[model samples]
Target: MSPTHFISIPVASPGITENLRKFQDLCGEKIHPHKVQYPSKLHLTIGVLKLFSDEEVQQACNCLSEFSAKIPPILCEQPLHGTLKNLRVMRGDNQFVKVMYSEFILSDDSDRLQNLADKCLEFFVERGFMEYQYNTTAVKLHCTLINTRWNNAGPRTINASEILSDEFELQIFGNCVLDRIDLNEMRADKSFVAENDKRYLNVSCVSFK
Candidate 1:
């Protein structure tokens, strides 16, 4: 299902943005600027919710509020620190890549972050929020840096085989802290493209305790 809304953890550190901006700038014309992810939009999505009405949206918002109060136990009163891994392509060959993202591997190689995401999804699912389902066993958290679907001026896929160079090092964004989770409303078309209008709305947010 296409997501009308999603629950995500914001990767808002300045260093993270600066690193991404530098890499995007280096790519220049090789990658469509239209498809490149804006620094402000970077986030690690947990899962999407298909809320079709105002009441359903409210229900999801309430879930965030209640879920946060219980986060201290799941997280042990600490924020999640994610180490940014190297850039990777999704779903296909590297020559015809469509989705390029940086995986956020949690600190100490522990499953704390993944477990937290699972718990949050279970919390909402039990409340009848109608979480948008995916084919994978679980939603993988990653920060998308480029997606060809967002650009119309070029072909559907880019030849990314040649660009994985030393210029883009592993863990480019370094360690990132995630202290807040948010529920944001997507655009009417459910696209992340910020062409002429705001791509997402900040409906609700909860900081970890």
Candidate 2:
């Protein structure tokens, strides 16, 4: 069976990408450039689907399209403002840091975003596309800045406290408008630079109110 694909919303703001690029450059100076994420590929994942075949992927896409059509468009009162505050790592029960990402917080401190994510998960679960088990303790709305799955294989630890000292604590990546939700196929060969290209097909875009 093929690997499972993901459902997510792409962050298309150029300002956000440029700011993240600067952070990546800093990480390059401290760690390795390739270890950091390409700014262009920043996204907020909605849910993961256990799609192993082409037919399943198509069915998932159709499901998302129908699910989106019924709901009103997602809206933010003030152009969703987010801040890249701290650097954190995701650890499993074995205490292995599998993924590294930036902590994102909205200025409004609203639950609307989390509600949207829950809705996405609910839609997939009800349709038998995904399991009902909760992956994380809570649905943390975030943007993945770096993932070591492709770059590094061994278990490692990073001193986030030392690295985040001084002015690097909080970085405002600028505001973004949540206009569309795209169902994208996860591909191993895809990089941040190729995200804007036609290689990735948007199976469905959730309409906004």
Candidate 2 lDDT score relative to the true structure: 0.61
Once fitted onto the true fold, the runs of candidate 1 whose alpha carbons sit more than 4 angstroms away are 131-137, 165-171, 188-199
Best by lDDT: 1
In order, candidate lDDTs are 0.77, 0.61
The TM-scores of all predictions, comma-separated, are: 0.86, 0.76
Q: Model 1: per-residue lDDT, tens digit, 152-185? A: 9777888887566656543477677888888987
What TM-score should be assigned to candidate 1? 0.86
lDDT, candidate 1, at 93: 87
User: What residue runs in model 2 are displaced by over 4 Å at the alpha carbon?
Assistant: 73-85, 92-98, 133-138, 152-157, 188-201
- Please report, as a residue range, the 10-residue window in candidate 2 with the lowest summed lDDT: 190-199
Q: Residue 103's C-alpha lDDT in candidate 2?
A: 57
**Model 2 agreement with the true structure over 5-113: per-residue lDDT tens digits:** 7777666567777777677666554445555566655677777666777888788888888887545544343345555555665655323344666655666777666
